[model samples]
Target chain A: MRVFITDTTLRKGMQSASLELTYEKRKELFFLLSSTGIHELEVGVPAHSEEERDYIKYLARSQHGDKVIVWNRANIRDVEASLECSVKKLEIAIPVSDFMIKEKLNKDRDYIVRLLKEIIPYVKSKKLYLSVGFEDVSRADREFVIKLLECIREEGADRVRLSDTVGVLNPLQTNELVKTASSFLDVEVHFHNDFGMATANSITAFLSGAKYINASLLGLGERCGITPLEEVVFYLQLIQGVHTGINVKRLYEIVNYFIDMTNIHLAPNKPLIGKNAFTNKSSIHIDGLTKSKRTYLPFDPEVVGSKAALAFGLYSEKANKLCKK
Target chain B: MRVFITDTTLRKGMQSASLELTYEKRKELFFLLSSTGIHELEVGVPAHSEEERDYIKYLARSQHGDKVIVWNRANIRDVEASLECSVKKLEIAIPVSDFMIKEKLNKDRDYIVRLLKEIIPYVKSKKLYLSVGFEDVSRADREFVIKLLECIREEGADRVRLSDTVGVLNPLQTNELVKTASSFLDVEVHFHNDFGMATANSITAFLSGAKYINASLLGLGERCGITPLEEVVFYLQLIQGVHTGINVKRLYEIVNYFIDMTNIHLAPNKPLIGKNAFTNKSSIHIDGLTKSKRTYLPFDPEVVGSKAALAFGLYSEKANKLCKK
Candidate 1:
């Protein structure tokens, strides 16, 4: 029930093409995220700019309760910058697969591991809560993944995060990877929603034994975005009976603030925070729901600061009549 | 890899409040559905009105190549009307849960089973492909569900549809129940997206062994709508390696037609059909994707008649620069 939300909006969400939160806006957003019970923030890459580095440093020092985590590559300079910024948590992201390391980073598997071993101790020397991220872990070989985790654990890294960098995993695969990895070390899941499986994958990871999940508000990240915080919070609390320490009612408010600030339209069908998540439009459903809300609802909408609306359309006269009455 | 699409927009989607497709519009819609490669069309309830019954008959006769199924309650009158309309497939809907049977239908479990037994033969006598619908099947007791399936199977029902009437199922439960039920009968899944689990649950059911799925175009139905046809089709074909009989390239045309005919706006983030489903917004993703679309895409969007867009706002310049270079 001790759920940790690692907000990747500054890093991953910035990848959302239309979203442009300035450095100052990013700092302001952290305060808003903190108020929503987010325990950690994956602020941004320190390698981006001196301004970005200074802002990350400012947030690391100035933010009161929230753990300011810096996302960085396997390079020592990025790790050192993150350390210099005094980030409480340093996520050292290393591409694990042949495709990413060879194609993207132009490095071999051994070099990636060697790079992590070299940088992790430097991070540990700074006494930072080190979470080594295996980028594109889903596509990485299982044995290689195990080897990397073992190496990281031996290097005194605090934990390892399984990143579904490409969002290619299904729930079953997610469970297998998380469970297998958890047996070796404390594992966290950082899922991408490229296939719309981010939230589901994250929940499966949690249920399968992963303790920490990486989430961004509204599933906002690069490509399809990361795991949605609202969805993870709702499922963990309602279905799994786990407490996330989230003020459930404040979810809508926080999401709305981000929508307004980012000028991104919240899709009405987006899970949890979307307009249609809690609304009932069918007459048969409304009639049954009117008798007992449980007849049509998994959980009360009010629990998530959502109100049920009567969707008026061709087949919803009963709901319309009930609403009118 | 053979996939089947059952459009339930008329039957289930019409149940939404303020959604009224006139008889003529309904017929036009039926024709439109038939033009698509959709395998089955669940036309409206035959017992709803004289007009509904006549329309069902007309569609059953005219909609060649597409199996016209009629929704009916587990009652003699409804079954007789469905038969009179010559619907080759009959989905006899009955509340399977104690809550629905007792509260909604004011009947006991025994009475419900008896009703099914009595109606099953009447429909089978007409040589109709019968699919018994267990409304609220997710909430029903597992043992009772097994028993109901057994009775339906014994009574010669061709298939059994497990309706997540209240949308109470998570992926695990959906898999377990569908797997168990599929062991007894040809299982079809009908899901409501009340908790954003409809598409996930439908896919889970298919993975668990269910052969048939019910979906509405654009996810148009009651409450949060049914399983999105586009999501199911895309995931099945792209991920599960299943061949849905749909003309993949024509999907966009069909979606556009539905949007125009219904005047329902497709949310920008809707999977497959939505404008943003294939749009790249992140600089990292755009950089990689522009080089090779496969870098971030699970499958080619053009396969489903969708083209990826470069969504630009705050994240535009860097991503655009990377793409242009």
Candidate 2:
């Protein structure tokens, strides 16, 4: 029943078009998200720049509840860089699917499994909390994912992540994958929104017993972004009756801040935090709300630090007509 | 194995903020959708105004593969308005949930059942094709839904719609509801994206033997909106191996056209049709694509009449660094 969110806003969120967030903006997002009860922040790639290393060190040294985690390739060099910054947690991702292993790394599945066996012992020896991510596991063989999970589990890796790297998994598949994987080890699901099922798939994975769910603010990521952090928290609270200890009433306030910092325009129709996510427009809907807010709204907007309103122009006109009648 | 899409762009999409499509714009959109092989189009609400009547008439009389469906309340005047336009198909949605039937309509479920019994014969007498939609069916009692469906079937309704009116149902619930209802009759799922799972729910419903899925251009509707037509078709095609007979290559074209006509801003991360849906940004992803596009991309962009490119700034910089090394 315990579900923790790992925020990748600093890593994946920065990959958006012209969304290179400054160090100050990163700190601001980290502070806001940390207060909202997110369990971990995948802060930055310390292997990238000296500034990134310093920022990771700063976040690690900060008095936030969020466990500052660093993203690294499945190589010792990236882990060494992160270790130099005093980062205690690391997520080492390796391409696992045949397509990715062969094409991306010019290597095969055995090469990746061997590489994991090679790099994981050093990470464990460094006394770093470790999560081994099987990148593109959605396309990889289930046996390989299970074998890799077992391999990591034996190697003293604390957690395992099965990434829908290309965002191709349907909900049913997502549920089955996580259900099977969780039986073996602590499973996390890192989903992308390429086909727009990431939020639902994340819910499925969580319901199937994945302990950790990876999300990004505003669903920002490489292409279509990941499952949104707000959406995961909102759905979990309302749909599944699960509490993540997050201050959901601060959801929109934090999302708006992220949007302001990134300069990315938010879709008004986005769930929970969108401008119209709680706005009642149609006269029929407004009239229904006048009698019962639950008539048109699924949940109270106050849960997300927002409120419902009768959409100004036409709703007023409709009310006028009803009055005359 | 059959999943038919009913596009409601002209009807629900018009409810978007300040989105009033001119007659010419509507006509253009209608032609574009028709060309893309969408099975049905829920044209404008002819009962709304005289202009709406003319627009419905124009679309109904036009040559296309789409069956023109007119939306009506659980009353006869709306049907008569549609009949005047020679509309061949009708979707009469009645509130089925206790909350909607009692609070919104100020009537009980039985009243709605009797009302359906009263108005359905007249619609049949007009020799129009009929589909009875149970608005808010997801919240209604299951037995009540079954009884109402039996009532509609007895009244000779052609199809039935089970709406998650407030977007309350999750994917598992969506599948069960649609599955159980489909056992009795032809069931279509009308989902709202209030929970941001409409596309997944729609896919679930379809996979669970529901025959029809109601969608919109950009998922436009009353609040958060319905499942986006593009996401449904894309998921069905790529993930489920289902052929939609859709010219998916024209997916982005129609979406861009809808945006241009409505002046609504498109989300950069929107699945299938967003500006960033096919854009590759991550340096690691771009590096992988250099070996094979299949490494990172799920489907070819040409399938949707789009192209993929390395994200402008950082991806280029990564390639430059690699070249210098």
Candidate 3:
């Protein structure tokens, strides 16, 4: 099955302490990501600031403008701010878990139900493609989620975003959650990498019939970040035999662009885009590379527009002997 | 089901360019890992260097000598080196995939069959507990893997290790392979994180009846590294209700110790151990944390010997209002 990618690098990626992109860099990143053939680009929360709102406005008028999705809290003021940006698409996020509703939002489920009754029709009336995000869905009661899904469907929303806000669910759990949500509406997913399973969970969600996958460059976001765009894109293309329209060749350029714009130092062993992802240091791997690249190489580094090479390390003497042989 | 952890920080973790522990630091790390209640510690490859052999020998004579497992090639010389160290346990590693056997090892499957015929009995005869590692099994033919498993079991080996050398397998694939191998003998898993699925795959292998999981601190190893010990242990204990006998509270200390010893900088969003793994930055997350920690946290950070806190960022204005309320 094919998967659709919604790159949220500019929005969720910017909220973290690790990355802060200027307006020009944000515009540059938008264009760079647009070239990658991703389905949508979640640019920013218009309600966050006037600058953020203005940036959303600017991006809405830029090339590939239809792909821009403005993020907003499920509130009238946030919806008004997004409307001001003239964005065609909006993702209205609200806490669905009782923990989040009672503690964070200081509201009840009825408050959300009533709010949705007013906001959903209002946003749809303006001809915006509405995507409702259930924040902290991982901890939400299953029955409550089903009830909300029915409510969301009745409101004529285009899709539902199940957000694992804290990145707690495993692939099996993610599969079940996506299955439950997909039964009612088109499903989008936003997974965080808190337990280092975001990529796997994102892939599982897609396998369970998710139509949209939210990811970020280098998995940049709050806390442990979200599913990395590079890992999800390449894994889908190479391992699962699922084609996401992302230009696999441009991944390195996009990753490098993000790093350059943010001055963040990625570990050399970072999946797909790390400097050493294609480098072989062990003698066994080197010998394999020397004879047939398939032994230790999963796929050609060139598949992602990168190169593979050998290096000297603790196993150099053995590698040297193999070479001599 | 209970899972056994084999911490390979001193062996696989040191192999990556990201970490090069000094001899003193290596000894320090050994004790640090020892204190964490890990089942076994893969100290080093004895044949790699005289220094590594000496370190293994030193560790063998240390307090937790029985927990040390010396890694070796499936050759007498490597076995001889380990025997000299007086390490009671050994993990004999060899290329098992046709790609690795024909290309890297420059040997046929018959050659490996003959080698194992000699090596397995020879090591077992020494009264050494043995674990045989099949490198690059992710790409190995299913029939060949079963043939090897049958051969390995016939050779009187204690266990078999399925090394996903290039991290190509996903959770579903891992479950099937672990199931296959478990039918013949006790199964141990060594997964690479090339696609960011090592932690999930390792967990899946355990769930599918693998007794041992080989993990490195920070997932450091050749090319994208292996599963991170922190993620695997915490996931088992907190999420799956599987007690791994590892002291979860010491994970932070051990991770920090590794960083301090190696002078490596981990990303603040590195799963489980990052600086921001417990820090909430976004106003939505902060508001949740201010009300109920569970609103945004997957688990109490103190479960892993850490604390959670909020930070001011782009959404501080909204967060400030939430705090006032």
- TM-score, each model? 0.93, 0.95, 0.94
For model 2, the superposed segments whose C-alpha errors exceed 4 Å read A312-325, B312-317, B320-325
- In the order shown, the candidates' DockQ scores are 0.44, 0.60, 0.61
lDDT of 3 by residue, A124-226 (tens): 9999999999999998889988999999899999999999998878776787889989999999999988899998888878878898999999998888899
Q: After superposition, how far is residue B242 of candidate 3 from its true place, in Å?
A: 2.2
Any runs in candidate 1 off by more than 4 Å, and if so which? A63-66, A320-325, B1-3, B16-36, B63-66, B309-320, B323-325
Worst 10 residues of 2 chain B by lDDT: B312-321
| Tens digit of per-residue lDDT, candidate 1, span B56-76 | 888877836237888887888
Q: Which stretches of candidate 3 lie over 4 Å from their true place?
A: A318-325, B319-325
Ranking by DockQ: 3, 2, 1
Q: Model 2 captures what fraction of native contacts?
A: 0.62
